[model samples]
Each structure stands twice: as structure tokens, then as C-alpha cells.
Target: MEMLYAKWLFNGKEILKGLGCVSHNNMVVDLLPIKLAKKTYPEAVVKDYGEGVLFSGFVNAHTHLDLSNVSIEPYLGFVKWLKTMIETKVQANETQTDEAIKKALDSLIKSGVCAVADISNTLKSCNYLKKIPKAIVFFENYSLRKKQAQEKIAYIENNIENIRQTYKMKIDVTAHSVYSTHRDLLGYTMLKNNPKFGSDLFSFHFLESEFENPFVNSRGDLFEMLQEKGLIDNQLHFSSAIEYIKSLGDIKKGLFVHCVHIKPDEIEYLKSIDASIVIAPRSNYYISKSLPNLELLKNSGINVAIGTDSLASNWDLNIINELKFLYKHYSHIDPAYFFGIATTGGYTALNLHIGFKKGFYAYPFFMETTTNNALEEILQ
Candidate 1:
């Protein structure tokens, strides 16, 4: 029995002026003109959010909630950051990781994130995501050795369902990247999970660094570390990450994360597969001193979403702060475009319904502004 009117309302798409959102029993009922809404709900209590835009909160398409407690600083290059993060993981106790997961979820909630696509190694964050309306916990397959990959595969085959039931979380196994996961593990997990769930768009950390190109082809530092006693030189090597992955099978609609170094032909391939990508701009700048081509991605037909990565790689897990960063630095792109990816594109990527739909839950948030450039004002 509430009627909330705003100067502008965003429905995960276009912004409409002078609309009222009607909700009852804590669920959104309809959106209509203020006058029409009045006629529809004659006895409802009303509140006008004057000089502002009211929107359903954002969907964070990709993040590592488990690393929320890991401290990060700028200018720590990718390799060093990875080493530091590994050291911290080795040292951090179970309680510490649990606390970090709780804090990360709380931060995302307070920052107005409606849903999340969280990358987890242990599915520990799954325990704390009760408050989020939609959540996808991607358990990473990051074994560099065949033995480790075999052990993990055995565990997944025997205990994945039991673990999911125990956690009460939708945990799906997926590859970490070209350098970390073995080719066998990648194909097995992806082929195993990609068709079971209707929206089985398992995410991959693809091409976040320029070094990955050489690493995948067995010519980089990462490749040297990946060498094991029984592993053949070309057992895991490929012409490109995309080619190796495509060799696995035709997994249409895969989610590619941090595509900072995605090439032109690769972009065309992504479009052809109807793929989605999540961009972590701040994390890229912090680790590699480069941001993805936001202008180009904005024009690309592939579904695009945004992420904050983790505190281990970036400052924080606030999608708003991330959007603001993109708005300020990547000024060539329109602010609304950033906003769109943060909302609709992210939901699309995660296979969740767009917010503000009737008969659905909408965690509404707002930006107070009188300017016609409300999106720009809020973002800047």
C-alpha cells in the first residue's frame, strides 16, 4: 500500500520522467504516470522523491567476494599481486576468510547491488549470500598440474551435488583461466555444467592481461610455472585462448570476464557466439596499467556487464564506485551506457530478470539530482 513517485525512474533500460512505482505486500505491483497511479490506488500512502532518479539496484556480474579482506595497492603488477594474494590465502585462517566474505556481502548490499556473480575457490561466500536476491557462485578450477586436476575432478564427480545441497547455493565448477587450469579440467567442467542449468553461462577469466596471450602459447613466465614432470609441451598450449576453448566444444553464451586484451577478431567471435563479457576497469588499471576499450565495448553487440573484481586487485567492491570511476576516466563513453551495463546488461549476463519488472522483487535505490543530466551528475 505504498505509492512512490520520482522525478525520473529507471526500469533497467530507459529513464522515464514523472512515474510512480506502486508496491504492496513488499512487492512492486506496477509503474505508471503519477495521475494514473493515483486513480489506480486512491487510498495508498504517497511519497514523492523529488529531484532525483529512482532505480532498481545494480547487478554485479563478476567479483571475488572471498578476497574482500586482502589488501591491495596500486602499481603492484599482475605477477606480484598474484604472489601476494596466494601468500595471503595460504596464511588466512578459516574464520578470517568467513569474516571477509561477510564483510564483502554487506558492502555489496549497502552499495545497492541487487544480485551478484561471485567467483569463489571454496564456495565459502555461498554461506553468506542469503540477503542477495540473485547469486551465482562459480567454484574455480585452478589446478596447474594434472594430478591436482584429477583430484579436483574426482571430488566434483563424487561431492558436488552434496556440497551444493549442504551450502544451499548454486555452485558450478568452471575454469580460472588459460594459465591456471589444465585443458582437460576446463573441457570437463564446462561441458559438464554448461547444459544442466538453463542459464548455465559459466564465466571464465579471459584475457585480463596481455601476458595471457603468450602464456597460452607456451612462451611466457606463466607457461614456465605451469610445467610439470609428466606434462607434454603442447598438452595445454593453444594458438589462442579462444581457439583452445572452442576446441573443447560449442558452448554458446559463455561469460568472459575482464576482457582487457580481447582483440578485434575475438570481439567478432564473441558476437557470433552470443557471448557476454564483464569488465573490471579499476582492477585492470591497478594490476596492468590498462583499461579495456570502453568505447568499443559500448558499440559491440555482445552483452557487456561491469564488475569491481576483488579488494585484492582493486580498491573496493562497490559497483557504484566502479561506475563512477569509469564515468570520470572513460569520458568518451556516455554515462547512461555505464549505468545500463551495471544494471540490465549485468542481469542479462547472470541470466536474471531485469529489475523493476512487475510481479518481481526490486531493491530500489536513488540519486538525488535536479539536473537533466541526472545520470552524469550521479556518476560524476
Candidate 2:
């Protein structure tokens, strides 16, 4: 509603005192040219700090904030932690959940995250997200048993249609994980959906753990687990993690989460498909005691994004903190480049727009590396 100036804002290229001003509502608004700056009548005026780095809001491409109500503790292994998570579900009640999700969302927003490609297991937090103008939800589906695939896919497809019609916010279906989703189900979703439904930018976990690698390649542990649970039998044939996805043929355009155990050859294969990657370093460390081979992904010319996974596996859903952790652990990573990954990379992967107009802009005061500008001073 009101006009304000920023030293810079990201476009195809960065603009400084350009013909656009950030609106009071935080969406980027077009302004009169710098030459007309003095003549433009203003209802209210604000000045740029002239030194801070201003850019579009960050996009967290992967998260499970519904589990935000759960407490995080050190775990022994991936499967072990998952078991604990299942056991603790009954203990996490509404009050704790409300506090955690609300706080996590607040922290993410304050750190300048405008959009998230969050995975939802249910509609519990759906209403809360609907209330926010920025956040979006992707209801994820996870079914490993081959027989259950069709029914589960139908449920997801119907649920997605329902959510889109019901809410003003955007909603989509994220295929759970390479190991968790059955081959037939993946094929049906990609085939039946076609241009509109199939290959609809599906998100899933891939090669995040050693156990997953074998389970997918040879129907190992998870297969055995399913068998023990009476979900599957010995007859179900399985393929390699990436191979099963490749078998889908036409499905490209996707987000692959947590490639921690991803090999060099697998990275090459992923590169062939042209899908992007979202590395949840903190979450990876918390669950698997490992981090992704960012060096490999970067070297392969793969576009990388960042995500603060759910509170169950992550301590906080703060993108700034995630970026900071990335900077600290991976010393070779440039802060500006990593910031771009968090914003532009994520936005492009999920097909979302960002600008000052959306209050989806980030001001990285730390980029200067000299002045610790107070929040008010830098924002002004």
C-alpha cells in the first residue's frame, strides 16, 4: 500500500534503486524510474539502508511440519529413529503440536521464507497453513506394498483434488520415497496423470540411507519388514532405487530429497533426468548421521536447494539457520550462492514466484561480514 526503497532486489539480474519498490505488504511493486523518484507523490515514504542485500524470500522445498509437535532426540540409526517416531505419536497432543507448528512457521517467516514444499501426512495442520498467505502444502503418499498401491494412489489423487478446491492455497501430491512407493503405483500416477496429472513435479526421498539402497535394489530390509507386517510376500520383484524411477520413462521434472547415500554414478543418472535436489543437511544428520555429497551434486552442475525437514527429524524449521549450518559445515560454499539455492533454486523447482511484494523477500545482513546491523537498522 505504501512505497519503500531497497538497495537491491533480485530479478534475472539484481537491480539497485530500480523502477520497483517493496510494498508495505512486502510484495515487490513497480515504481516510477529513479529519475522520477523526487517527483512521485507518496502516501508514506521509507528509505533504503543502502548496504543490506535484499532478495526474494527463501523457499523450503521439503518439510513435514505436521510432525512439528514431536520432540527430537538423538537416535541410533535411521530405522531405529523411525520406530521411535511411530511410538511417540500418541504422546504428541494438540497443545504441543500447536505451539511447535506455530513457532516453527513463525521462525521460518521471520527468517524470510515465503513458500515451502512441505509434505503432509494428514490435514491436521492444513487449516493452520491455509490461514497463512505464504505457505503451501503437498500431501505425500507412502505405500510400499504392491497390492495397496492403486487404492492409495486413488486416495491421494482424490485428496489433492479436494484440497485444491477447498483452499485458496496451492496443494499437490508428493510421492513419498523411492523405497517406500511401489512400482505399479508410481507408474499409474505418472501414466494416468499425463501432462496434467502425471509427472506433476513429484517429490520423494532417494538414496538417503544404506538400508534403503539395498531394500530398493534387492528388496532387502524394508521388503522383509513389509513381509513381517503381512503387507507383502516373496513374489514381489524389486529394482534399484533410481532404476525403478527411471522405469517410469516420461516422469522427469521432480524434486529428489536427501541424497545422502547417493553415489557418484547415481548423481550422473540424476543429472541425466534434469530434476533438481533439495538437501536437508540438519535432518540428514539427525536421522541418518550423515550429510549429502554436495560437492558431487555441485560438480555435476545440478541445481541444489535447501529444506528444514519436519521438527521430528529437525530441531528447527528456520531456513536461515539451515543456510548458516550449510555455510559452516561446507566451507567451500559461497553464502550468496547458498542463499540463491534457498530462494531462487527452491522457487524454480517448485514453480513459485517471489518478490518484495509478497513479503517474501530476504535481507541478509550477514552478507556484509563487517557490520552486525540491528534488525530495525538493516530492515529500514
TM-score of each predicted structure versus truth? 0.92, 0.82
In terms of lDDT, the poorest run of 10 residues in model 2 is: 367-376
Which tens-of-lDDT digit does each residue in 142-162 have in candidate 1?
676777888887877778778
> What lDDT tens digits, residue by residue, belong to model 2 across residues 1-380?
44554444444223344544535555444445543653554554655545445555667788887888776585556876765765575454778777777787787767767677778877566767753445667767767676577788777656666677776576666667755677766665544345446546677787777777567554566556555656443243345677667667766677888888777777777777777888999888888678887777777777787898888888788787787777667766544566667777887677665644344443322222124332222222
Q: What is the lDDT of residue 251 in candidate 1?
A: 64
Stretches of candidate 1 above 4 Å error? Answer: 25-27, 192-199, 225-235
